[model samples]
Target: MLEVDGLTCRFGAKTAVDNASFSVQPGCFVGVIGRSGAGKSTLLRMINRLEKPTGGRILFEGVDVTALQGRDLRRWRARSAMIFQQFNLVGRLDVLTNVLMGRLAGVPQWRSLIQLWPQDDRAIAISALEQFDMMPMAAQRADQLSGGQQQRVAIARALVQQPDIILADEPIASLDPRNTRIVMDALLRINKHFGITVICNLHSLDLARTYCDRLIGMSAGRIVFDGVPAALTDTIARELYDLEAGEVMDETPDFVTGTLAPAFGTAAVA
Candidate 1:
C-alpha cells in the first residue's frame, strides 16, 4: 500500500499542497480532479519526489521515502513513472531510442553512454511499442508524429519503465476528443493488464467518472472530497470546483447524473 501522511508543499509563503493525506491500495485506479491551480499537479509531483515537500512523509509499504537521496531517490523515481501533459520526448531521437531510455537506471552507465543496449532491454522496448500498436513507427523521429500518436509513444515509453505506479499529469489535456478516448483507454488497459496503479490528473468529469474507481477532489490546495465516483454528488462537485447550483450540471450534465456513454461519443480507435 502507498500512504501519504500530511504531505505539504510550500513555495515561499504560498502552500501549493497543504497537508494532503491519502492512501492507495495496490492496483487501484485513482483520479485527482480540481480546477486549475488547486495543487493537483503539485500533489502528484510531490508523490513522485519531483517536488520537495515541506512537511509530512511518503511511505511505501510502511517505509518512509521522503528523505531518500542520491541512488535511493533515483530508484524510487524509477518505480513510479510520470507521463506529462507536454509529451516530453527527445524530438531529435527515434521512437525506439526514446522508449529505451527507460532502462537507463538498470543498465551500466558505460553501456548507456556507448549506446550498447542489451538485447533483452531492446526486446522490452519493442514489446512496449507493439503493445501500443506503434511498432511500425519505431524508427520515426518523435517530432514527426501527431499529438495523439506522440502521446501513445509517450505511454509506450512509460510502459518500458516497468513501474509499480504511473503518474499521469493531464495526459490528455491537449488531445482532441477522439484522441482523449484513445489515450484514456490505453491508460485503462495498462492498469488492468499489468496491475499497475494509475494516479491520473483529469479535467473532464465524464472521463473520470467512466474510468476511475476512486476520485480525490481538491480545492484551494486542499483535498476536500475523497470517495468513489458514485459518491461524488452534484453538491460535492460544486464544492470541489466552487461552482453554484446548476453550474456543475451545465458543465458536465451527462456525468453528473451518470448518463454518459462508456465510449464517450468518439470515433473508433484507429
Candidate 2:
C-alpha cells in the first residue's frame, strides 16, 4: 500500500498542494482531476519525488520514501516509474534503444553511457515492445512515431523498469479522443495484467469516469471528492468544478442519471 499523509507543497507564499492525504491499494486505477491550478500535478510530482513536499511524509510498502537519500532514493525511483504528458523520449534515438534505457538503473554506468546494452537487457526491452505491439517499429527512430505511438513507446519503456507503481501526470492531454481511448486502454491493461498500481492525472471527466476505478476530485489544492465514479452525483461534480448541478449534468453522459441516449439516425429519418 502507498500512503500519503498531510502532503503539502509551497511556492513562496502560495500553497500548491495543501494538507493532502490519501492511500492507494495495489493494482488500483486512481484518477486525479481538477482545474488548472488545483495542484493535481504538484501532488503527483511530490509522490514521484520530482517535486519535494514542504510537509508530511510518503510511506510506500512500509518505508518512509520522503526521507530516503542517495542510493536508497535512487532505488525507490527505479521501482516507481513516472509517465509524463509530453512523452519524454530521446527523439534522435531508435525506439528499441529508448526502451533499453529503462535498464540503466540496473546496468553499470559505463555500459549505459556507452550505449552497450547486453543481450538480456535487449531481450527484455523487446518483450516490452511486443506487449505494446510496437515490435514492428523497434528499429524506427522515436521521432518518427505519432504522438499516441510515442506515448505507447513511453509506456513500454516504463514497463522495462519493473515498477511497482506507475504515476502518469496528465498523460493524454496532447492526444485526440481516439488516441486517448487507446492510451487509457493500455493503462488499464497494465493495471489489470501486471497488477501495478496506477495513479493518473486526467484532464477529461469522460475518460476518468470510463477508465478509473476511483475518482479523486480536487478544488483549490484540496481533494473535494474521493469515491467510486458511480457515487459522483451531479451535486458533487458541480461542487468540485464550481458549476451548477444542471451544468454538471449537461456536461456528463446520460448514464450518470440512469438515462439512455435516445436512438436517432434511421428512426428519425423515417
Candidate 3:
C-alpha cells in the first residue's frame, strides 16, 4: 500500500537518508532496524512528510504523497499517524482528554481549544484506552502515569485517530524490559487485530525478529537489507553492522524483556 523510490534527504553536506526504496503491504507489520546514525528515523519522517525529501518520490495507494500540500497534506498526515519516542501528550491533561485530542484533526480548532469534544468522540477515545488495558488510568493526569502507561496512552491516541498506517519512531527506546513488552504487545495487538499497517523503527534486533513480519536494515543513509525476518541470515547481519552474528545476538539481552532475548533466532516478532 506504500511505495518509496530513490528517496533521499540531505542536511547540507550530510546525507541523512539516501536512495532508499521499499514498499509496505496493507495490513503487514514492518520493522526498520539499524544503529544510531542509520537513517531509520529519517526515513519514517520522510514517509510522514515531517521531513521533506530532497529527491525521489513516495506513493501511497498509487498517489504521490511527496506532492501533497495544504488541506490534502493535513488529511494525509492524519491518516498516517505518528507515535514518537517520547510520549507527546499534554501531561497536565487527563488521559481521556489526551486521547480525545486524536480526533482534533476533524474538529475545529476553536472547539478543540475549548475542549468541546462530542460524546461520540469521547466514547471512541475511552474505548481505545480500554483496548490497550488503559481504561483505569483515563482519569489520571498523563504525566502521573509510568512510562509504559504513557506509551500505551499514546497508542490509544493513535487508535482513536483511525489511522491507516502508524509510523512509530523507536517506540520502546526509553522503557524498561517489562514496559518494553507492554508497548510492543500493544503494537502487535493493533497490527494483528486491526490490520492497520505499522512501520516501526526499532533498535532491538530481537524485537524486530520477534515482532515484525519483515525487516528492513539501514546503514548510513540507505537500505542495506530488506526481507522476511527468517531471511535475515547471520551473514547479512554481520554485514549490516560489521559484527559477527553472535555478537549482534549477544546484545539482545540488553534490550528485550525477560526471557525474550534468548529466542531471537526462533521467535517471529509476534
Candidate 4:
C-alpha cells in the first residue's frame, strides 16, 4: 500500500536520511529502530510528506507524494495520520473537540475554527473515542487526563481521520512501562483489527519484537538490518548499535538485562 524508493533527505550539508527504500503491504505492521540521530524519525516524516525529501520518490496507492501540492497534498496527508512521542493535544480543548480536529482537513477551516463540526464528523469522533474507551473523558479537558489517557486520545483523533496508514514516531518514549504497554497494545489492536498499515519508530527492542511483524534497523542515516525480530543476532545488533559482544543484551528489553551469546546462537541473556 506504501512504497518508498531511494528516499534521501538533507539539511544543507548534513544528510539525515539516505537511499532508504522499503514497502509496506496492507495490514502490515513494521517497526523502525535506530540510535539517536540515526534518521528513523526523518524517514517517517518524509513518508508522511511532512519533511520533504531531497531525492527519491514516495508512492501511496500509485500516487507520487513528492509531486503533490495544494489541495492534493492536503487530501493525501489526510489519508495518513501521525502520532508523536508527546501527546500534542490542545490542553484547553475538550477531548471530543481534540479528536474532531482530525477531520479539519475534510472540513472548512472556518467551521473547524468556530468549533462547528458537522454532525457526521462529530459522530465519527465520538465513535473513535469510544473505540479507545475514552468516551467517558470526552467532556474533559485534554490537560485533565493522565499521560496515557492523553496518548490514547491522540490515537482516537488519528482514528477519527480513518487514515489508511498510521505513522508513529517514538510514541512510547515518554510513557512508563505500563503506559508503554497500553499505547503499544492499542496500536497493535488497531493494526490487527482494522487492517491499518502501521509504521512506527521505536526505542524499545522488546516492544518492537513482540508487536511488529517486521523490523528495520538504521545507523548513520542508512538501513543496516531489515528482517524478522527472531532472526536478529547479538552480532547483528551489536553492529547496528556499535556495541561490543557482552555490551549488548539479548533477551531483556531496553538493554537492561540478558547476556549476549555467540553470533547467531540461541543463548538467553538475563
Highest lDDT: which candidate? 3
lDDT of 2: 0.83
How well is each residue in 89-205 modelled by candidate 4, as lDDT tens digits? 999999999999889898988998789899988888877777677989999999999999999999988877778999999988888877887788888877876788899998666
TM-scores of all predicted structures: 0.90, 0.89, 0.91, 0.90
Candidate 3 per-residue lDDT over residues 1-270, each given as its tens digit: 899999999999999999999889999999998777889989999999999999999999999999999988988888899999998999999999999988888888898989998887887887787777788989999999998899999988888888899999999899998898888877887787778899999887788898899999999998999999999976787778665345456656444433322111111111
* Regions of candidate 2 where Cα sits further than 4 Å from its true position: 243-270
- Evaluated against the true structure, the overall lDDT of model 1 is 0.85
Query: How well is each residue in 113-168 modelled by candidate 1, as lDDT tens digits?
Result: 78899998898888878777798999999999999999999988888888888999
- Candidate ranking under TM-score, highest first, comes to 3, 1, 4, 2
**What is candidate 2's TM-score against the reference?**
0.89
Q: Which model, 3 or 4, shows the larger TM-score?
A: 3
RMSD of each: 5.3, 8.7, 5.6, 8.6
In order, the Cα lDDT scores of the candidates are 0.85, 0.83, 0.86, 0.83
Error of 1 at 31 (Å): 0.2
Clashing pairs in 1: none
Q: Model 4 misses residue 44 by how many Å?
A: 0.6
